[model samples]
Target: MISRIVRWAAQLVILAGIAAFIGALSVAPAFTYRPADMAFIRINFTHGAPRAECWRPTQAELTKLPPSQRRPNDCPRERPAIVLRFELDGVVLLDESLPPSGLSRDSPSPIYRGFSVAPGPHRLHLAMRDNPRTKEYDYTSDFDVMLSPQQNLVIGFDPRSGGFRIR
Candidate 1:
């Protein structure tokens, strides 16, 4: 009978100790997102454009390739590198060049970038160049954005619309 009482007492003590440990975690140290004034900016897109215009294949050139593999127009396998620039309130935040993807270098180039800034109204300028031979930008946009605390801003490219979309 004494042993049985002792075992029950030990179990109750252990349960109480566990409950106390859990209760301590609720108040002693606090954790938060840590900051309330920082906002985020993200750029992500995958784009594809020819470095130069395609041309009709000459009769002699077409004859060189196998009959099944010959194409009506001859296009280069290598695409131009993608150049992107981002500016905020006249301060340049990012400028980068990305090479073409795929083994044959004919695929779209993918880009993903991020930045942190204070939450407020700011001017944003964005430009991109997909043609290596051209000195002009293929796409450009300038606008103002009002960011909120902890807001996530995303800029994506849509060739169908011919520019970047902010979300």
Candidate 2:
């Protein structure tokens, strides 16, 4: 009688502990993704330019080819790979060479990345070169930023606006 009651009470405690352990496991990832006292900076953009080696055919060159062989001046559907660089407080953080997107490499390459940093003021340097001919970056931006804990700063490009923008 007394033994039966003790055994049931012990089984109930064990079952409750198992349930609590599973619940904690489910919530652990959520907390890790948004830890306290850290700010995140997001950089995302889609940019590409025509490959420098792809050239337009002159009239003489065009006439020598068949009608099917002759294409428009800008008919090349491929673009050059893009080079990206990011610096924080004069230290290099991210440097990547991204290939163009699309089934045929005709579309703009997209980049989406994030960096975690302590909340404070820092100098940021960003540069990107979509063109392959020149060794210089087509777009460069440098500025000082102040960030708060748990904040997110997003940077992206606007083609119509003709430059990178931050928000």
Candidate 3:
């Protein structure tokens, strides 16, 4: 009888250990965490523009199309590449030219990048040019920020707002 009790206790303890192991595996890590002395900035954006040269369909071409298919302008399927620039305190940190959409280059090109920096006050500058032919950027943003240790700064763009957003 005593041996049976010992056997039951041993089984209970083993079951408890298995349950604890599974529970540990199921638990998630802390929502926010960072290693010693580190901070980062993340930028995500998507934008595109049609080719600069667009024209109305020729009368013969329009006639071939169904009445519902006719449109004022018929733009080429290809789009221009996007130029992205990021600066930190007047120093250029990232300068990249991203190709437009996909095989046809008719979709929006997306941009996602991350940069690591020391935790302190700094100036940030960002610019984007969708038109490869133009020297000037279509959108620009500049700001001064104070960063804390283990902090993450996010930047994005909104076409409707016509500017970059920082958070």
Question: How would you encode candidate 2's per-residue C-alpha lDDT over 1-167 as one tens digit per residue?
Answer: 99999999999999999999999898776646665799988998888765656578888899999989887573566887888899999999988889999998878889999999999998889888877888998888887899999999998987568667788
Q: Give the per-residue lDDT digits (tens) of candidate 1, residues 68-167.
A: 9799987677887888889999998888888889998889998888888899998999999988888888999997999998999999999789698898
| Residue 152 alpha-carbon offset, candidate 1, angstroms | 1.0
RMSD of each: 3.8, 3.7, 4.4
Off by over 4 Å in 1: 15-34, 54-74
Clash tally for model 3: 0
Most accurate candidate by lDDT = 1
Between candidates 2 and 3, the TM-score winner: 3
TM-score ranking from best candidate downward = 1, 3, 2
Q: On lDDT, who's better, 1 or 3? A: 1
TM-score of each: 0.74, 0.72, 0.74
| Alpha carbon deviation, residue 151, candidate 2 (Å) | 0.6
The 0-to-1 C-alpha lDDT of every candidate, in the order given, reads: 0.88, 0.85, 0.85
Q: What is the lDDT of candidate 2?
A: 0.85
lDDT of 3 at 150: 81
Q: Rank the models by lDDT, top first.
A: 1, 3, 2
